[model samples]
Target: MKKLTIAFLIITLFMPKQSNAQSNGAAGAIAVGAGLLAIGAGIAAMEDMKERAELTATQWVLANHPELNSFSLKTLDFNGKKTKDMSSTSVISFKIQEFSPTDNPTLDGKKQILLAFTSYGWISDQGIDFNKVNWYLIDSTEWLNMMVAYAKVASKEKNETVLKDVLNNGLVVNKGIKAKGKTEIPFFKLEGDMYLVTDYSSEMKLVYNEKTLGIFLKDTGNLVQMARAAVIDTHEFFFLTK
Candidate 1:
């Protein structure tokens, strides 16, 4: 785990910077325009209904789960879309860290989970609302455990279907729906039991309801990769389950 963390940090440290330079040397102008455009677009596309719902959810999580108060919120653009055209779609991420009771004596009395929250959304064409597509909450310890469990299960069973089944059915829990606008938002709950057998320093899991939409691993991988690419030596990586 330490090696993986170090490797990720090293790669991030040397990653290319996001340049806005253009061929005509109007880079600064273009950048300023783009920034203003994004801000304007965001404001113009703002949907009070969605914002209220998101705020409600965020407030509920913060008030109910005080342990997650330290987590940060962030916004990002989607890079995997085929069209290079700019859109109102954006991603929001939250991250936190969890340590074992024995490892951190100070926090031993507190909850055992270090939770992170991240999500993705798009601004409507009308630019009056945001359409959220994906969201995730994870415990670092649980994530480490799950990875180890996956490796072990894969080595033993070598069956992708079975492995997927174990991950989707046995390890993950379907939370209820979150009403946002006209859409019924699906959510999930996860536990540490799924990854306890793995030799990981911690355990973590993310959940989403399949009745509304299927969560894809590839999307999760992309989010992780993007977060890793942006920050070096920082355990706070952004991600979403679907």
Candidate 2:
């Protein structure tokens, strides 16, 4: 984790777009996030390192998400054909709140557990492949972080006023913003210090920074940014900003 922290600090220090000004104006924030993704892609070039990083990341998710102290992950081939030496597309869907393929039916008709690694598209043909191969776990809600991601975006887009007026500062779970049945889940909360913690009921912590929308897995007091999940402009009712 020290290694990743050093990497993060280096990135934060060197990131050129640390300003709020952009030709695109307020829209620049999205551009800034995009820039960060490009920076992450440029940070490495090793299969072994990528594997270890992904595994560590998976462990973090297991520990923090859905109160799972023990879980297993397996490498999947993705069974796709268009593999043309690091394509820009990912076989695994990076869709916000992505669900399992409906066609992949199960005997009991329950939704299959899926914790897909979505960092490959960011890595490109020459970078640290955090998830070199596609992956999915069995019977997992670990991906609910994606839903938390939607709340993050909505907090900025549709509900920006709610955040600034009500939650500009508050304790974590102790001070949560209530949701309607449309977006209510008893487990979600805006943890103090701005980490949007989802699994508040567990010893492990699954948090997403409202500032960066970077989802992390926390265990034993260490935080690791395993993935960046964002919903740019599409809200249930709001339109995209120009």
Candidate 3:
């Protein structure tokens, strides 16, 4: 019973917005809990949580969001193990389908189902903290366009300018940010010495003064070979400011 209480406390404290995995939130607690529990049960706990999360998320979505019934379900990389490395936060994303036939397509007609958890452990969406759990939509077409622009720059077929347009436009189209036809690269401003980690498999990590802020961007390998370069260029940028 005490262990269960501890787990609940862990879950409450770790609930993060968009699974940012701050120095004080989700990543730290889950990493410690997983490490201690693994000594006795091996590394299955995290994987089990992921599986349960998928089941619960699927059910919850179908029940609450009938509009997505026809779309396919796909579980995205949640960065559960990478949380231990502090390279990324744990976020579960499900891509709904090939295209959006709805009267209002999210982005060129595509939908994304996203759910965030405080830990890798499976907790029913009902039992989980509502503040952390989120079901949102992303413009898949715009995101793909950004990736294609990056590929162009990588292959030397186009300059960074094209990529920049796609990324900034994505923000306006998907997020509805009031940019007023301007380029706004999402970046974090931190104080003190900064540490930049570039892990191709993991999301981009922004560490400041030895504490991890969170994963700034996903699939950063496509942005640029080095994370710093991605932030420095016009077509692509992470925008880490001091």
Candidate 4:
């Protein structure tokens, strides 16, 4: 986490020495310093949030599914997909380094499992949106195909509508569709237990198979505990079953 220091700001302000130079140089320095501070603060906040989320995920695994602890955890960057706007997600990818006795046959055979979480201030005052936290079993072939598809569109410098059209109808996985035995979304083939976002208050919870699993609050005090438990439980319910 990067922080802006008062000493740095003061030094920047004093770096301008002459009469005319003092006014313009000091103003420019102040602007640059302020920009740097804002960038630093933003980066620090993002890092803090990711750490908190990861901690919460760890707690969930430890408390409920000690068996899953065998799988190594890797935290990825904040942006799941690059966009021109403020939209982004924090990602955590779990990989099974080796075969384990407790591993789910379905999950253990795969390369990696991904968990993507995000919070949008415009959507709700609540911290992380449970529904927005997505889990997926990574299929390297499908992923690569999607990436190549996207790259083709990107290379063409297509307009936004064209790009969206490609995403909506370009890449089709007949095998995924047949295996899923359902209609597929443009870029995604939905699988596993589905969940809906029902609460946005100070506390967050998810109800699945008639079981409620959370009293998670929307703050950093118990962030690790909240996130870890929620993630592990959710994965067990959704991803593990798949």
Report the number of the highest-lDDT candidate: 3
> How would you order the candidates by lDDT, starting with the best?
3, 4, 2, 1
Clashing residue pairs, backbone N/CA/C < 3 A, model 3: 100-109, 160-235, 231-238
Candidate with the larger lDDT of 2 and 3: 3
What lDDT does candidate 4 reach at residue 82?
Answer: 21
Candidate 2 Cα outliers beyond 4 Å, as residue runs: 1-45, 48-142, 145-193, 196-198, 201-203, 213-218, 229-242
Candidate 3, residue 93: lDDT: 55
Model 4 lDDT on a 0 to 1 scale: 0.40
TM-score of candidate 1 relative to the true fold: 0.30
Residues 31-110, model 1: lDDT tens digits:
55565555555444444434544464466567566765443332222222213213333333333333344432332221
- State candidate 2's TM-score: 0.25
Error of 3 at 176 (Å): 25
The Cα local distance difference test for each model comes to: 0.34, 0.37, 0.41, 0.40
Q: Which candidate is the best by TM-score?
A: 4
Model 3 clash tally?
A: 3
| Model 4 lDDT per residue over 30-126, tens place | 8767766766676677677667666655565566556454554545433432222232333344433324556353334444444444444312445
Ordered list by TM-score, greatest first: 4, 3, 1, 2
| Angstrom error at residue 47, model 1 | 16
